[model samples]
Target: MIDRRDALAGIVAMFGATLFAPIARAASVQVAVIDTGPPSSAVFTAGQRALVSALSERVIPTTDTPGAIAAEVPQFIEKLLADWARPEDKEPILAGLGAIETRSRRDYKVAAADATPEQQDALLTLAMNDQLPGGADFFDKFRQLVITGYYTSEIGITQEREYLPVPGKYDGAYPYARVTKVFSS
Candidate 1:
């Protein structure tokens, strides 16, 4: 089992932090629910959910391994936002979603969902750049949520990576390839 805190910290470093003022204040109370299933009640609105799904699938598209959608990353994110994320974190999260649309319009002269995949990808790249006005924080937070949710999902653990329930005797001399798929417990 991985320590999620460590995992998040490492992933957060994947993109630099925003030096500007925080768009949304963080809640003192922590409210994350990584366990259980997709939210029983919807957290984001229909439009928001759709945007989240698009962003998630793009972030981790369907390949040989199950993609973010297959792993229920969007649903998981919604649950985290609705049930777990701090109240202050919510506004910025939603703003991040809206920022995609805003960027889409600016770049492609169309709604984010209406933008072509290539165009959307371009916008996402901008988000990743940390140069977009008021969008860097949202991008970092969204990226963290997607990565965390996907890796922790059943499909991510089993289909994407090897999972060992019970280990046999330790084999110090086991032949291993440097590129072997990671195994998770």
Candidate 2:
């Protein structure tokens, strides 16, 4: 009894409804999206993982202090990108990685990892200085994330920075020398 157009519309609507049913149900249930993927595997895309690894190394190299890699900074970035980053932010992140890779390949004829430590440092410095095109903000974001990940790690909080759990119990005023000594030691 229905016209051809009406019948086609009904079929299409049914197909769409069936296709999106699970998604609609999941949204209604409010599932908590968590990153349970293996950390050692390719967590981020190749470009993102490369950038994260490089930034972590640059921020906290293994030679001097325990660096971002040791503190699982790549894992942090992976989790952050999967759960927290906006869709709009992904372009810049990708663009930044591409730019860096291009620069490294063109300038040094090697990938970032294959480059010398000095070259790595120079690339990072240039990125930090906003010298690279199309990815300065991305570099800045990566640097900030690496630093944040490192400083918030168990090693960083207990070892590198002053982390006081209970500040209320301490005296309101203290001498600079005493405070500095307590914090430093």
The numbered model that scores best in lDDT is: 1
Candidate 1 residue pairs in clash (backbone atoms < 3 Å): 31-84
Residue 134 alpha-carbon offset, candidate 2, angstroms: 2.1
| lDDT (0 to 1) per candidate | 0.79, 0.70
RMSD of each: 7.4, 14.3
- Can you tell me which runs of candidate 2 are displaced by over 4 Å? 1-27, 30-43, 166-168, 179-185
Candidate 1 regions exceeding 4 Å error are 1-42, 172-174
- Cα lDDT tens digits, model 2, 52-111, are 687678778775457788888878777666655544545666677777778899999998
Q: Write the per-residue lDDT of candidate 1 for residues 146-172, one digit (tens) a residue.
A: 999988999989888878788777777
Q: Would you estimate the TM-scores of all the predictions?
A: 0.74, 0.69
